[model samples]
Target chain A: MTDPSRLALVPFVSVADMMRLVHHIGLETVLTELAAEIEADFRRWESFDKTPRVASHSDVGVIELMPTSDGSFYGFKYVNGHPKNMKEGLQTVTAFGLLADVSTGYPVLLSEMTILTALRTAATSAMAAKHLAPKNATTLAIIGNGAQSEFQALAFKAVNGITEVRLYDIDRSATEKCARNLAGKGLTVVPCRSAEEAIEGAQIITTCTADKQYATILSDNMVGRGVHINAIGGDCPGKTELARAILDRSDIFVEYPPQTRVEGEIQQLDADHPVKELWQVITGAVPGRADADAITLFDGVGFAIEDFSALRYVHGRLRDSGHFLELDMIADPDEPRDLFGMLMRAG
Target chain B: MTDPSRLALVPFVSVADMMRLVHHIGLETVLTELAAEIEADFRRWESFDKTPRVASHSDVGVIELMPTSDGSFYGFKYVNGHPKNMKEGLQTVTAFGLLADVSTGYPVLLSEMTILTALRTAATSAMAAKHLAPKNATTLAIIGNGAQSEFQALAFKAVNGITEVRLYDIDRSATEKCARNLAGKGLTVVPCRSAEEAIEGAQIITTCTADKQYATILSDNMVGRGVHINAIGGDCPGKTELARAILDRSDIFVEYPPQTRVEGEIQQLDADHPVKELWQVITGAVPGRADADAITLFDGVGFAIEDFSALRYVHGRLRDSGHFLELDMIADPDEPRDLFGMLMRAG
Candidate 1:
């Protein structure tokens, strides 16, 4: 058999390779770069082909396919959310993504997105905080200290100049683990005994719990004036982390209203609730923070465009990083119409 | 860093491995097995979750994700169709697929579906012909001698006892190439100059042209009584292969009504066209071929359940075939909640 052609091979980044690339470029740098890419894409969000994720729900969890295109390139992520997986020693969320050329419809890159989703989620949160949070804010309060807590802390520190992160989880060991992981990450990590203690002096609050129910990690009374709340954990229908009272008191900003209205914290509110699109705020079409005393909430259900931005960022790094394997995923017959001839010759 | 757990490893079958596996199992046996599997799935089609493919269309081509599940396992195929690619020495279609365990939402198998799609499509066509075609049908006329022609011919031979295949393509070289590739195959191959000559004395007429636009590959006058028409090329919107008159004269059977009404030859007909569901025919809910003189047309725009069945078939072969590579595609942290700690440990 002849060697497969260049078009037959797609660069694939494994989990170890992704970790190596992150450590090689420095996680803070990757997060900052991802934020820049996401911000740039968000600034021109109209150029994208956007749709709500296609989801398949089951008794245990949900599997979703999020796809988007920018006319020149197409990308999609296959992600699963199984909260019950953790008890069986499996990550609650696991994902992988692919990027393809729009002209030829051939995949160019495939990568493990479990780690990248963490980084992109954090980067997206921090990027939103840069615009919605109070100017010169330094402290961030993380309501759930699980797999995503440390990445969120580092992303805020790297992208928003955050100097401290207060972590709190129902399980004390989770908070301790988060603090231990962020020991030398150039920020002060505080393991708080309760969510109230964690949000005492924090100007930015991010909630990313793994519960699959409508549990209020933040209530109306606990939140103060002039604070930005990044609600990311309420990413599916029937799952939210913020109380209805808290949402009513805050000015809400969201990524893709059609999706956020069903999956974000805003799902608890009326369908006709007025909320600003984050892209509009980024593009200067809408104001982000109304006043120094006004509360702002970013209801973030992860969108496909963010994943496209992250995959594009990773694709650009492949040339210099050499952190991918070329898999013979596509069949390239020498004579385009002679695929059977190629197979017969191989035999 | 510790080695990735077994949960992180996904079995990936590449193009070469797929070719090798086909040869190892013998093409005829594989096609017969695939036909049986597709037949079994079609019998229980109501048990599967079905949806039309999610497609991203461009001026030049389309890329699609087809997903389905049978409650126990979930599967999806990522496929592309760029008719212009053949002019640039690339296959007009390429595909890959993944099968995941529904309980955990973890991928178990990823395989190159370009060859497998060809096989499954042919198997599907032959399986459909089994119920619709005249008894003892021995000759097949393939109208478009492209990448899928030979597979269709062989599958008909293996599953429907087709002893001769008449091949015709607008480009005569494509027919010559197909004939040369099927030289030593059990069936006799004949090259014809036009579609009219190809269908003469043939019992099963298979149309699989590569045109992205609607073309009258077969007209009403050319198709005779008692012959089963397997139209597989009219797979996308605005890409019908047969003339509208032919569709009006035949009793059409379709995989899925909503999708076929938009993508198959039935697109040129009414929205409420009288067509029998192929699964209903397979399950004996509907009668197939009312009489020997009745004209039966199978409007086959491939469905997700067929791909799901194909992926499941390939996955079952993996236990003894050993023609796959283990890919570290999933991130498996020792503590499910400590993904950041796993990354830090990797560093």
Candidate 2:
């Protein structure tokens, strides 16, 4: 191999570049491509390295770093969740990620995942719903109507042919905001007064409430048979929304079994509760939705592979469109051994 | 908090910006400011959130993520050590780091620390040496003089006022490289045949060999009274240089006791072997060196806080010079509630 130091530094995709990519490719296309990449990566699940995230919890919130590498590529996401942030006029969850070459440990791209995260989360929901939800599903009831509600609504529209969305939030303004964001998206938006009203007769019930407690947004009787439940918000030890009765009645699916056991809707379920990993469903190694009457629950807690796929998707789009700036994040010493030369030259 | 959505997007500084900061401030000034920041951060040690680094080890190398936060700001370093990398014409160690806001979870700066790590490691050594070494120290012995030797020499110059450096390495070319790198720095660089020849009468001794196994570089008799030892290279399990007799005879100081007990030169010694944390010395809670006859050993296994301080210093310097590029690493929704709009509109 040629000297690694002699290789030209890789181009970095900054947040601005990522936004430009969205503008150039169109947001719908970005989500479409990102979803496709995630699906492809998930299908070849055995080809990557996986690990449970390392989390540091504080009284106000939790900070986590999710890392995974596919032997050749390494990706990690740094995210924070502070329920009180919204009260202080901050978003409840915020994140960013990095993509690097495993061989050299040099970052190849850094993209803004805050918006991308919403896109991916929604895409992931839609992706799971594709396999788990009944075909020809039309309406999605998004109970939370917060930052993630819009993405969830549109992703279902693009993937599952959903033409209608029922939005409900404790704060009416949040529900109004969701409707307004989805106004021109060619989907019918319904404003609901209560979570029950939103979930009533909906084919796909997405529970994304922000409460960091075990509050049942969907009870056992309210969730009917053949309805797909995309549980998005409850993702911590003390935080979960689905009642145990609801979980026991549904055929559950999870992103990673080890992680989902702790952070997904299954947190309320017993350890012995049989669940299928999403990858297994995608790979056809396990069955998804044994019968139409069997209610399917996609216990989505997000995963590192999704971020890796999102990063890879964004990197390709950003690089092709010339939307990024070159970050001198790596020191290019003429002689890698003479790192002191950089200092001497600086002096 | 103007609409919270408008402020959600965070700014990112790239590596190019960090190099500009170095160009604008000069390396010595940067190192001095960095050392001062490290000292300040150490003084307030209890206010920060600390965690032991997470490392992924491979047969030929090890990659680690060291993360920490001070309630408000978060930092993490991605570093790798492959002693064989140099032979493949790559630096034995390469690193990059990030600094972010804890409130918004936005990355503010990304910097190349492969070179800066050497500087910070040297700065950390000098800081410990200042507190532990005998007063008015001059001659210094640097065993295993490789890529890190020049920085060690200069940092000692900046902090300990050492005028002469004795260099010895198993690879003759590495010692020659060290000598070449320090030729005109005004310090007398003497190339020696062995560790014994290098430390015959030195007041300060620094060992930084790169072997992965336990190799005794220094025994009891070779180390004399009042000689402060900066043990830098033996930083992982199954990797240590100093014999047990040397540790038994010395007054050892460490960065963090829990971490040092696992990864430091003291790994060869008993678990309950008494040691002093560097922060305690900085806070004046613990004594450094009692007298001229006392032998003080700084088992430097590299700490997360030093990386935190270094990243903070780099962020401040780069921000001041306007060299940092704004990476749209943070997602900014015009209306925080309209995150879906940002993505949908892009599509």
Candidate 3:
């Protein structure tokens, strides 16, 4: 254990501990609660210092830093995506983040965000569906079944009452694994041969494929009218999955517009294309879907605000469960400026 | 303490512990070692993916994110500067940073840098001075005597063999505090009444005023020939201290050109003005001080590379000392994708 004499503590939640929280809370409940927290944060969106994430791209993959702050709290996430990682026995994405107190610039929590990212993405998709999807929506078409597919399925089941799910992926084993892992979850999971077959009659369509380049996973002809699409794969520059015709016909919503214009599905469109921010839709400042026939899309590139919400949620939940580890991320000193002295006294 | 099974550990050094390290290892050794590390990292500069820092300016202060990667390792620092913090009984600057593995994106070290920052800044300045300052230089004029002043005084004495220091600050109490802090340091201390008194006959002039606006602390006429000026205070946009004439007359060196152009003393000059990056000089690619009588300037806006160096130093020093605490910052799992399952197993 760290020195108890320290002035502050940074609670760390490892992957194992995070999964325990998920299992105890249940996947559906965690997603629903996360959505509620996200909605609450969005309702007071004006309080945050918002910006699009900063990204550094390399030939192999992209690494990004997403930071945001309210007057009282600060949060940032370090995340990377390398589609080739799976071939190397690694996940496609890995993330970690910090929640800090603005008053003293001290971190309160540090957490592994790999699993949290999946959960937040699912929760965010479900949150977007609360506004865009039809009230009678009960079925979801999950294209590109992978690590995130099960979480998305469970999130939809919790937030949108989605009871039926059709899964499809280029790799049949991935879809089968997703189905097997999600067994006895009280949902009907149907394996489909292709993306077109998966979206046959579903009201909510989520595409979370792990492709580093542009591949048209969904063309305009295959996507039906009024279907709410959560496009999670097309999240980097020059990497999009949907055809321009589909974006042109849909009502697009984004986390942050300036970022979406550069890195989201909206990158496929012109600069002047109008889109509503999800915060605006969540806060009722803008319309989501005006009619039953309105095709709505949530171009999910992931935002710092969602990570902020996720970090805060995990910090709170760990406290409730009394399962946390103290980290020596910050120094505690009797005299703040005597940093040199602190070291001398360590022994 | 964190979970022992987690592969990555977060080792933190507090201000007091850092001081203890300095006292134990000796200040001279720390500066010498830090300089070597900084120089080593810069030698293979092409390996690093570097970017100008992203800064968020508030009414009272500025917070910034500085990130860099060398394919194998990644590092970033979260720092803030508010001159008014002292009035509120706080340090003028507070910082923390992380070093991570690029391949796995796991943090290996998390450190409190408020004290380390002061050390690294001084080490960097002394490193630059060793190249730029004339041979047989033995005196330094420090123009700011705030919390960082004592560190600067000690670092210069340790790294450069300075035997005398002239201290000056706008606040007399701060100057007195610095004098008291450095009383038994084996150097002659002169408390000066004015900036003119401080610079007289000094081989090196270090300015570290804590103003966030453009305030001239040195004039061209006041600075004599052959003086190596360490410009440490001017780091944010619209916040510069060097007169235009001094810059026009001196041979300037910087940490990162892209960043120094925007936030360093060079921010006041035209974009086309010539300047040498410190790395180029350190690596023998460019000339630093051409002659003994030529005025030299080191525009010191703290860089991520330096923090990376400092993190490496602290991590090495604390290993056997056991002054650090392990944190659950990385999520290591038997099944990487089963983040939720890891937590469940922990329970």
The candidate that wins on DockQ is 1
- Docking quality of model 1: it rates as high
lDDT of 1 at B31: 94
Instruction: Give per-residue CA lDDT, model 3, range B240-301, as digits (tens).
Output: 98899999999999988999999999999999899998888878889989998899999999
Model 1 lDDT at residue B128: 98
- Write out the backbone clash pairs for model 1: none
lDDT to native, each model: 0.94, 0.81, 0.81
Backbone clashes in candidate 2 total 9
Q: Which stretches of candidate 3 lie over 4 Å from their true place?
A: A1-6, A20-27, A272-274, A283-285, A315-321, A344-347, B1-25, B183-186, B219-221, B243-245, B270-274, B283-286, B313-323, B343-347
Residue-level lDDT of model 3, residues A1-347, one tens digit each, is 23634444567786656766777787778899999998889888888998878776766777789999877778899888878767765666878888876765566787888889988999988998998997789999998887788889989999989999999999887788778766788999999999989998899999988887778999989887788999988888988889889999999999888888988888988999999988888777898898998899999988889999999998888878765777554555445444444444454
Positional deviation of A8 in candidate 3, in angstroms?
Answer: 4.0
| Candidate 1 residue lDDT tens string, B218-257 | 9889999999999999999989999898888899999999
**C-alpha positional error of residue B218 in candidate 3 after TM-score superposition, expressed in Å:** 3.3
Q: Record all residue pairs in model 2 with backbone atoms less than 3 Å apart, i.e. clashing.
A: A15-B328, A26-B346, A26-B347, A27-B346, A27-B347, A28-B347, A328-B15, A328-B16, A329-B15
State the DockQ of every prediction: 0.86, 0.42, 0.36
Compute the lDDT for candidate 1: 0.94
Global lDDT for candidate 3?
Answer: 0.81
